[model samples]
Target: MKEERRRHKRLDLDVKIELEKLDEGGVTTVKYIKADVSDLSRSGMGFKSNYKLDVGTFYDTQIQIWTKEVIDAVIEIVRCEEKENNIYQYGACFVGMTETDTLKIDIYQLFNEE
Candidate 1:
């Protein structure tokens, strides 16, 4: 079995998310790609993107963690594996999150233990 390398536990969710790719210079792109937030944690989140995002690349994202609540963040692409049906499962790590945002995610994870 593959070892779980994640530092934080994740909550299975379907939150709405928008991701904007960053250029090599770490500049945010104008185009924002929409994808479902399949899973979440204080450290990072998971989703699938139609566009192939390179691992180690940076992206700016807006995630609707709760109804009527959205948080903006920067993330580094950690994994991008091509799954069946031509979809890519993308995993990223939060890069520039505040203490408040980290607490919010911890609270959410606590409230949503599977």
Candidate 2:
């Protein structure tokens, strides 16, 4: 029998976070935690949140890296699934991430070198 292998980029040091949807004109929103990032890709991320966000809902959020550097980006809810503990896992696609923000994330990953 052959064993099946799964491929995924491991994530480390998940910190507590808060995310909020931006307003129409100006960027404003309600801050709420439970936004723990689990998986991250070039164009999206998987996170846990108690708040229910509709698919396609766009949010402008600031991710605080372990280095204390903040990376700001816009994200859109792509999918959501309810977990066993009443916690919700959300998959968000990067809607509009600035080059600087993307670069910051890449650099952080390099230094961490999981």
Candidate with best TM-score:
1
The Cα error of candidate 2 at residue 44, in Å, is 1.7
How big is the RMSD of model 2?
Answer: 4.3
**Per-residue lDDT for 56 in model 1?**
91
Residue 28 Cα positional deviation in candidate 1, in Å, after optimal superposition: 1.9
Query: Which digits, one per residue and each the tens of the lDDT, describe model 1 over residues 9-64?
Result: 98888876778888877776898777777898888989986778889988888777
Ten contiguous residues with the weakest lDDT in model 2? 4-13
Clashing pairs in 2: none
lDDT of 2 at 75: 87
- Across residues 1-114, which tens digit of lDDT does each residue of candidate 2 receive? 855232334345476667777767856677654588886655677898777788878887777777888777788888899987778888788878888887777777787784
Residue pairs whose backbone atoms clash in candidate 1 = none
Best by lDDT: 1
For model 2, the stretches where C-alpha displacement exceeds 4 angstroms are 1-10, 23-34
lDDT of each: 0.82, 0.74
Model 2 vs. true fold: TM: 0.75
Measured against the true structure, the TM-scores of the candidates, in listed sequence, are: 0.90, 0.75
